[model samples]
Target: MASTDDNGVAGYDILRAPGASGGTFTQVGTSTTTSFSDTGLTPSTTYRYQVRARDAAGNTSPVSNTAELTTQPGPSSGTCTTVPTVQTQWGTGYVIQPLTITNTGTSTITGWTATFTLPAGHTLSGSWNGTATVSGQTVTIRNVSHNGTLAPGASTTSVGFQATRPNGNTALPSGYTCA
Candidate 1:
């Protein structure tokens, strides 16, 4: 799309929502041509996108229609791993000792997230050092700004959470995956 021939159209600005539900859009890139490519995004995560034409004078046209896509899942092997330790427990509640995030790859990592599923009847009561989200039995934990970014062979033990489960249940979480 073009605006009045102020300088003609020079490029397009690309915007993306941080999540799948289109919460909000922020400029993620600029493309001088008709196409753009975004890289280094998290795998299996949904994103919403929009583009607007820009003039040489830096004026922008109305945003184009929204486009949404979900990236394919990353490979099973990643640069990092998250391990939880049990600190304490009671009849119906337990504290997961701080989680340790370790970078096993050769390069520094900007951020990381871990996913796992709790046993039936378990619910997260709270967390620290990381943001936690629970859906049914699945939990997703993401590094906070201050704790992210790790160099090769580095490790951080700042993430943890507490949860409640059925009294006397001995089951623990399984299927841990971090990337």
Candidate 2:
């Protein structure tokens, strides 16, 4: 079953064997919906299953009425679609800055990178989880290792260095944009 709220409502599991009462169940993974397939059951074996629903607030409803079926021995395969969305935040510091990257996508996101151009007379002091390169008067942050799978809607934050010269322009940094 699916929760469809995008707030970490994935799927539920059957907690008991056939005809068993007072079984416990749990939620697995983070998504709106989940499906289960009984592919390896012996052809003549009977199986019973139930479903339930959950929300981001950790609330669960009564278990679904049980259903029974026999599995047909065969090969089975299927796929689910997941996408990735991202959000960024620029911090409060004027020169020493922090950027928080959040993945709002339906799928995992990896190897993410962001670039910004420095204003005249401004230079980057240092960076984390990435490399900062400068050419002419522009600075580029590259090779960022967002090594973790931003699972559907996870987030990571990084910080970098910038220096303002005595005659630095008061205008904001260049080439920095957020969606």
Candidate 3:
């Protein structure tokens, strides 16, 4: 497996078998701090691994002390769970309500779709990167793609939206909780 370290430098690989030759190796995934994935191997076969480190200056460090493990039978599957909480704030205006979504989950979030529905009597004046639809008294912003994966503890900010309501009333969206 190839991995990236905390500084975003990306030149690391793990040799899964020390004495075994010609084992196919490939990168699984990358993030700021870590990368991991299961590789295809013979069931019940013992494998050794050695991790090597690299720096931005093109300098490579010695491989880590070798470690050993045995591959289990068949392919393994795992689930990525959503973070329990997200941080949010209300901007000054409907058009300026900037929402920041964070991923506090144990696994990386490959993407996120956020939907915001404006309250009654409100219409969306402008929005960025989000599709806005007005139906009756509700204005819905849907499927705003953040474009990049949000790693654990990572946050991304959505573009602002302008909203107009009667009598200068601030229109807050219902069911606007983030997590």
Candidate 4:
């Protein structure tokens, strides 16, 4: 931001507003130079920015024209992976907890789905943190509203399920795939 002040500009107040249509402006930073770097911003979001100049006498100039930008999207589902770990087992049933879903991509992921195959004679009994559906021996789990949207290299352990298997059968689920 540049301003021509008869009293000589002392500094510039950097203001920021969120959204494409613009919102209330707030003082985000002060800069003696012409630029500022805004950090810790959410991925795939829109933000508006403006600047105001302050002179040595403490007089404030009008804000500059709004500048809008939208950040790039985060990692996609193609870079995600899922792993299901057996937590406990009894004679007739077992549990899989902390089914970790990790984003290994370079950006943020909007959502994720995991698919795996349960062995024969096994049935899913319950699940949490994700929606689970069984089609024959194949189980599909999708992230719920809150657990979706992962940043790069981030992981969520909230997905898991409980299942019943044949007595004395120690087989675990296989073919864990994420997208």
Identify the candidate with maximal lDDT: 4
- Residue ranges of candidate 4 with Cα displaced over 4 Å: 1-78
What's each prediction's TM-score? 0.59, 0.39, 0.40, 0.57
| lDDT at residue 147 of model 1 (Cα atoms) | 83
Sort by lDDT, top down from the best: 4, 1, 3, 2
Candidate 2: where is the Cα deviation over 4 Å?
Answer: 1-94, 143-148, 177-179
Question: What global local distance difference test value does model 4 have?
Answer: 0.89
Give the per-residue lDDT of model 3 (tens digit) for 1-179. 22344444556655565334456443333323556564566776776666666566555556678667776653212122222122232344444445555665667665554555667766667766556666775544443555336677776655456666666565565554332
By TM-score, rank the candidates, best first.
1, 4, 3, 2
- Candidate 2: clashing pairs of residues: 2-33, 3-32, 83-106, 83-107, 84-105, 85-104, 85-105
- What lDDT tens digits, residue by residue, belong to model 1 across residues 6-118? 58888889999977674889999999999899999999999999999899877789998889899996653439988889898888988887788998888888788889899
Q: Taking the tens digit of each residue's C-alpha lDDT, what string does model 4 give over 1-179?
A: 23455688888999988999848999999988887889988889999999998888777888989999999865454479998788999989999998999998988887898999999999999999999999999999989999898999999998889999999998889999998
TM-score of 4: 0.57
Runs of candidate 3 with Cα error greater than 4 angstroms are 1-93, 133-146
Query: Which of the two, 1 or 2, has more lDDT?
Result: 1
Error of 1 at 47 (Å): 15
TM-score, structure 2 vs. true:
0.39
Question: Distance from true position, residue 76, model 2, in Å?
Answer: 28
Maximum-TM-score candidate: 1
lDDT of each: 0.87, 0.49, 0.53, 0.89
